[model samples]
Target: MSEEKSPFVVSASWLEDRLDDQNIRIVDAAWYLPAHNRNGRAEYEAGHIRGAVFFDQDEIADKTTGLPHSVPSPEAFAAAVGALGIAETDTIVVYDGPGLFSAPRVWWLFRIMGARKVFVLDGGLDGWKHEGRALVTVQTTPQPATFTPTYNGDAVTSFDAMRAIVDNGSVQIADARGPGRFLGTEAEPRPGMRSGHMPGALNLPAGSFASDGRLKTLAELKTLITEAGIDLDRPIVTSCGSGVTAATITLALHSLGHTDNTLYDGSWSEWGSRSDTPVTTEPTPKKDR
Candidate 1:
């Protein structure tokens, strides 16, 4: 028998062939910025992969934190996924609309919560549709499945931890926001937030890791990180606007067997808004690039 692919990702046809596997559970983690005027839940209702449950990123977040998409309490995460009938043992497949966008956040969340078998849909929903695969408007209501979560606290970072990391230079900071946003050349999409980036952080825009709605191969991802001067062996703390796309970096790191990476759950929204945290507008030096 052929060796099974990495549980971290699977192709469209691979998932299609196993769509009916009773142990398989699919999640639609599609989300868009308000600027696009697109609603995730509404779009999912319009049409999505068959047997896919909608994992509402914005809705499932911890509202107590002022930061957008803050990591929820372990109890809250367990409750949320349990309500979705997602058992801890289920083989989960997560996907987003344009592909490598928001789905990696949900995928990272699952791994941090100790799900043994989870994967992101290669090429995402757009790729599946482009291949003329079937989509359904009908809702898939799964029976509630108990999900026992053991949160990996080390796999995530808080604002305080990020500050300390910056001060101590213990972990490599990988900012996943675009270069424009990283260099203060572009206005922040969110109001009331300062433009630019955290001190001592390097830009690694999440969009660069994929093309045409699919992530690049493993070799490409490794080269991307190395070319940016990031030493893959060092511990990394991934960050981006809010905290969603940061997970993309975490996912990429995980796919390469690097386990010392963590997501800064508050990301730029928290760092830029704080009066105490120092934000820099000077573009990164060419030597660092």
Candidate 2:
């Protein structure tokens, strides 16, 4: 299959003009780490973009896996989104508290689940509010719509698949954890988690792709990515603490027209927890020209 050809990022003004459109769906995919001490659902209940539906990541996940926010099954995904009154044919736009943070995970999920017009709001809620856009505390309940999901097998990488990829050195591993975590110089935010990255994995901290909490332009993203030692031409798989920030890299790469990529669903949260899996605290940095 060829790479996705359309741009998936939209501006706040663009959305404001279509806020009342029936065929469009806005999703609040905001989430926070435990350290942030914020409640995503509660925040959503209080106020969000005028007509957005909240997508709770923790609730709509595969519970069988002893991991956080593992990808949900196709049936579960369809039901979850369908209940939110989101249809497969609607123009879906996802946004988080800060721009380009956790929303890309939702964007990636929608694409894999067969939503063709899914996009991410460029500035997130922060950007929307900055533009003096009005937000209301009132809630909306749309008519429940039916959605059928067709899973794209290539979008996600299993733990076993990650191991094999590491062993084969065919697909490049881009760890979105910060440099300190990747180099074992800083402690992991999640307690009991190990330091360092997967063997042969390169560091591409998710935060670098944005400035002042908004995603950078295409040129800025290209520079940030290339400087981190990733070759856009190579096949890559992105991973992070809990598979959340990994989608940031996935989004950046996709925005750059590099579609030969996949996310490790069971990222470091799963990989670092497994005893049989090999991990190291040392870094052998790859020099990117």
- The per-candidate count of clashes, in order, stands at 0, 0
- Which candidate wins on TM-score? 1
TM-score of each: 0.95, 0.94
Cα error of candidate 2 at position 259, Å: 1.0
C-alpha RMSD between model 1 and the true structure? 2.5
Poorly placed runs, candidate 1 (over 4 Å): 1-7, 285-289
User: Candidate 1, TM-score vs. the true structure?
Assistant: 0.95
Predicted candidate 1 versus true structure: per-residue lDDT over 34-86, tens digit per residue: 76687788878989988999998877889988778778888889899999989
Give the RMSD in angstroms, all C-alphas superposed, for model 2.
3.1
